[model samples]
Target: MPRMLLVTVLALLCSACSSGGDRYDPPGLREVTAANQCMEQCQRHFDSCMTSSSSVDSSDRCGAGVATQRDTRCDTIDNPDLRKRCQASADYCRNRLPALTCGENRSRCVSRCGG
Candidate 1:
């Protein structure tokens, strides 16, 4: 009976340990969905800025502002996967930003956030 009890306890202890796939996300690590949502909000802000009647900000200015906003929100993500994806998108969009309109820039900027 003591041998059986020890075996049962050992089995329970082993089961309690986490395996490779069961690992939890690190603290402050944002999920990919969160990244996507953040980018969506950034796009909305850019759209609003572009349509606003304020003459102080040009379309190019709006594009720049949204790019800043995107980086501020998405670039700071703690998750490595999300950060890598966001940076790649930002790089791709920024390179073409000078040639594209604000709306076009926004689309490219948020493209990679989606899983």
Candidate 2:
């Protein structure tokens, strides 16, 4: 769907940027892959985290778990800004948690970012 397309587009853009090694390290390709994987993981887990009708109810959901996975998921992305970057995706999942059923987390995230 549109969410996948947005992810694909963002991935393509990242790939293009990573290919231009003039700015990144020679091993930056692996880093890009890892970062992408981590983001995907975060998104997935975020969806999982909001399984309840009220995800904001911290007792059932744990932000730390998602934050941990994202922060340590990628070794290449050593910017130490995973929290900041993940916020958009996390916010997307958070806002959508009110749904009675599981919904499109990616679309939520993408839309949250104005995609």
Candidate 3:
């Protein structure tokens, strides 16, 4: 009887341990993710544009021009609210890109995007 009771208790404990909670994402997460992706694309485009527009010595001027173009393009997003959020995220990325390493930049942008 003691052995049977022990087995039952163990089974109960195992079942309890295996109970997986709901796996739902928080609200606005999808939107934020989309905006982050868009911002990354914009940044890549800006980098490419800068590379083609000027030599290494003129990088500062090129970067400024590219940033302005990126902001203009990002700001025209169809959804006003999303455009604002995306532009904010893009601005964050632009401001921090020169100061942070690649991994840190990604982490900071993700956090800034509300992820």
Candidate 4:
């Protein structure tokens, strides 16, 4: 099981590295679809993280916010309490994103406790 898990993990990493796309773009006309995709990806990643923390799963949980943070109009926080504040900011971004547009996305983000 562990060996299969390792192969799956490696394959995921390689695919992620190769499947490059314009991640910064808004949802275009299909905001809901785009948000759903984002939300699905986030959920899958978070679920994998819950099952496995021996690798980049920790980063996956938080990295799920990358899309949200990019979309939100937040200024970079100063270094007063850098780590916590930045994480909080990311959390907020994730919450505000996929709210009304994508119901599934919104629910998943909420359950993820990103807000």
Task: Specify the highest-TM-score model's number.
Answer: 3
Which lDDT tens digits does candidate 3 get at residues 76-104?
A: 78998887887776666555543233445
- Model 2, 1-115: lDDT tens digits are 9999999999999998778465544747876677677667656755664554453553234354563454355444656586456655555544444443344555565444433
Q: Evaluated with lDDT, which candidate comes out highest?
A: 1
lDDT of 1 at 38: 74
TM-score for each model = 0.29, 0.26, 0.30, 0.24
For each candidate, the alpha-carbon lDDT, in order, equals: 0.64, 0.56, 0.63, 0.56
With a 3 Å backbone cut-off (N, CA, C), the pairs that clash in candidate 3 are none
- Per-residue lDDT, model 3, residue 89, is 62
The residue-by-residue lDDT of candidate 1 on 1-115, one tens digit each, is 9999999999988877744456676645468558868798867867765565244433334465665566777857999899888866665655444325566656766776652
- The worst-scoring run of ten residues by lDDT in candidate 2 lies at 53-62
> Ranking under TM-score, best-scoring first?
3, 1, 2, 4
Between prediction 1 and prediction 4, the one with superior lDDT is 1
Deviating ranges (above 4 Å) for candidate 1: 1-64, 97-115
Q: Extract clashing residue pairs from model 2.
A: none
Q: Roughly what TM-score does model 2 have, to 2 decimal places? A: 0.26
Candidate 2: where are CA atoms >4 Å away? Answer: 1-27, 53-115
After TM-score superposition, the amount by which residue 3's alpha carbon in candidate 1 deviates from its true location, in angstroms, is 99
Better of 1 and 4 by TM-score: 1
